[model samples]
Target: MSPTTVAVRAGFRRGAIELRNTFTNAQDLWGYLFPTLILVVTIFFMRGSTVPGTDFSLGARTLPSALGMGLAFGGLIALAQQLVVEREDGTLLRAKATPNGMLGYLVGKLTLMSTTALASMLIQLVPSLFLVDGLRLTSAGAWLTLLWVAVLGLVATLPLGAVIGSLIESARNLGLVMLPMMGLIALSGIFYPINGYPGWLQAVAQVFPIYWLGLGMRSALLPDALAAVELGGSWRHLETLGVLGSWAVLGLVLAPVVLRRMARRESGSRVAARRERAMRQVF
Candidate 1:
C-alpha cells in the first residue's frame, strides 16, 4: 500500500484499539467517571435554587455548564495524560516506526478523545432537560450552537493536549500540565458568569479558549445571558466565534511543531533511561 493509505488504515486500527482499551481499563473509566461524579455532586448541591429569577431549577444552567467542563477536562487533561503514559511506555516509539506513524497515531488519539467527549456531553444532557426548568430549547439555532461549541471545543483543546503530552517527560509530571489547565477552566466562567468576575479577571480569562467555549455554550442555552451581553455593548456571539477560531488555529499550528521537536528528543536510549529511573523510584 502507499504510505498515505497505510497511514490511514493504521490510524483507524489504532484509534479503534485505543477506544476499546479505554473502555476496558479501570483507570480510564475513573478518568471520565471522576469528573462526572463531581458534576453530579455539584448538581445535587445546587438543586434547591431555581434558574436565576425563574421557576427553572438552577440545574438547567449549572448542569449543562458542568457537562461542558466535563467534556473539556476529559478531552484535554485525560487524553493528554494518556498520551504521556503511552509515550513513556514506548507505544509512541513503536508507532513512529510505521509509515506516517505520527500522523496516524494522532488521528487515533483525536478520534478516541472526540468520542469520549461526545459520550460525556450526552450523558449530561439528559439530566439537563428533565431536572432543570426554563431549560427549554427555544430554537434550532440554539441547538446548532451547542452542537458546534461542544465539537469545536474538543477540536480546539485536544491538539494543545497532544502538544503538552509530547513535551512532558513523565506521566507523574502530568499534574504540572493539568493543574494550570484546570485552573484556566475555573477562571473561564464554566461555573459562573463572566459578569460576576472583575474586569481585569475577565480580561485574563479571555486569554484562554475555555472562556470562549463556556461563553458560546451559555449563548446557545441561555438567551437572556446573550441579550444581557448585547446590552452591555459586547458582541458575545462574534467574540465567541473569534476567540474559539483563534485558539483552534493557534493549536493546529503550534501543536505539530512542538510534537515534532519532542519526538526528536525522545530517542530510545533517553526513554529507556527515564523508564529505568521511574522504575527505581517506584520500587
Candidate 2:
C-alpha cells in the first residue's frame, strides 16, 4: 500500500483505540456525560417556555441548536485542548519524530473528535426526544439535512480548531480560546433568536460557523412553518453551504502552515522549558 494509505489506516486505528479508551476511563466517561446532563436539565426547565412569538417549546428548538453547538465545541475547543495538553506533555514531539507520524496523528485526532462529537450529540438527542416535542426526525428529508449539515459543520470547524491549537503556545492559555467561543455561542442563537440581537452583533455571529450550524440544525429538525421565525424567513440552505464552505477553505489553507511552524519549533529543550514553567506556575 502507498504511504498515505498506510498512514490513514494507522490513524483510523489510533482514533478507534483512543475512543475505546475513553469508555474505559472514569474521568473520560464523566467528561462526556456531564455536559449532556446539564443540557438535559436546561431543556427540562425550558419545556414550559416557548420561543418568542411562537408556541414551539424553546427547549425543543434548543435541542438541535445545542447539537450543532456540540459539533462546534468538539471540533474547536476539544481539539484545541487536546493539542495544547499533548504538546505540553511531549506527545507532539514524538509524533513529529516518526515517519508519516504527523499525518497519522492528525487523522487520528480528527477521527476521534468527529466520532466523539457525533456520539455526544446522539447521547443527548435520543434522551431529548422524550423530553422535547415537535422534532421532525420522522422524515427522510429531515434526516438527510441533519446528516449533511453535521458532516459539513465538522468539515468547517475542525481545521479552524487545528489552527487555534497550533497558534497557542501553552495549555494554560486555553481560556483565551474558551472565552471567545462562549461569547460566540451566546450570539449564535443557540438559546434564543439572533433576530433579537443588534444588526452589528447579528452580522458578527454570521461570520462564525456556530450560527450557521444552529441554523442548519433548526432547518432539519424543525417544521417548515418555523422558518418564519428565522432571520430570513427561510433556512437559506445555500448561504449555510457558502459560509461554512468558505471557512473550510480558509482553515484548510492555514492549518498546515501554522501546524508545521508549531511542530518545527518543538524540541527537547522547549519541552523541558515548558514543563519547568508549568511546574513553577503550579507551585
Candidate 3:
C-alpha cells in the first residue's frame, strides 16, 4: 500500500482505540454526560416559558439551537484544546518523528473529534426528545437537513480550530479563544432569538459559523411557521451554506500551512521550555 493509505489505516485504528478509551475512562464519560445534564436542567426551567411572539415552547426551540452550538464548540474549542494539550505533552513531536506520522496524527485526531462530537450530540439530543416538544422529526427531510448542517458545521469549524491550535504557543492562552467563543455564542442566538437584535448585531452574528449552525438546526427541527420569527422571514438555507462553505474553504486552505509551520517548530527544547513554564506556574 502507498504511504498515504497506510497512514490512513493506522489513523483509523488509532481513532477506534481512542473512541473506546473515551467510553471506558471515567473522566471522559463524565465529560460527555455532564454538559448534557446541564442542558436538560436549563431546558427544564424554560418549559414554562414560550418563545417570543408565539405560544411555542421556548425550551424546545432552544434544544436544537443548543445542539448546533455544541457542534461548533466541539469542532472549534474542543479540538483546539486537544491539540494544545497534546502538543504541550509532546504528542505532536512524537508524531513529527515518524514517517507519514503527521498525516496519521491529523487523521486520527479528526476521527476522534468528529466521533466525539457526534456522540455528544446524540447523548444530548435523544433525551431532549422527551424534555422538549414540537420537534418536526417525523419527516425524513428534517433529519437530512440536520445531518448536512452538522457535517458542514464541522467542516467549517474544525480546520479553524486546527489553525488556532497551531498559532497559540500554550494551552494556558486558550482563554484568548474561549472568551471570544463565548461572546460569539451569545451573539449566535443559541439561547435566544437573534431576530430581535439590532440590524448591525445580527449582521455581525451572521458572519460566523455558530449563528448559521444554530439557524440551520433550528430550521430543521422547528415548525415552518417559526421562520416568521427568523430574519427575512425564511430559513435562508442558501445563506447558511454560503457562509459555512466560505469558512470551510478558508480554513481548509490555511490549516495545513499553519500546522506545517507548527510541526516544524517542535523540538525537545521547546517542549522542555513549556514544561518548565508550567512548573513555574504551579510553584
Identify the candidate with maximal lDDT.
3
Candidate 3: which stretches are off by over 4 Å? none
lDDT of 2 by residue, 1-283 (tens): 9988998899999999998998789998888898899999999998999988899899999999999999999998899889989999999999999888888999999999999898888888888899988899889999999999999999999999999998888988999989999999999999998888899999999999999999999999999988999998999999999999999999999988988889999999999999999999989
Q: Which of the predicted structures, 1 or 2, would earn the higher TM-score when compared with the native? A: 2
lDDT of 3 at 108: 91
Model 1 residue runs over 4 Å out of place are: 24-27, 50-56, 225-235
Task: Tell me the tens digit of each residue's lDDT in model 3 across 171-278.
Answer: 899999999999999998898898889999998999999999999999999999998888889999999999999999999999989999999999999999999999
List per-prediction Cα lDDT, in the order shown: 0.74, 0.93, 0.93
Candidate 3 displacement at residue 113 in angstroms: 0.4
Question: What's model 2's overall lDDT?
Answer: 0.93
> Which clashing pairs does model 1 show?
51-56, 56-133
Cα error, candidate 2, residue 6 (Å): 2.1
Ten residues in sequence with the least summed lDDT for candidate 1: 226-235
Sort the candidates on lDDT, descending order. 3, 2, 1
Preferred candidate (lDDT higher): 2 or 3: 3
TM-score of each: 0.89, 0.98, 0.98
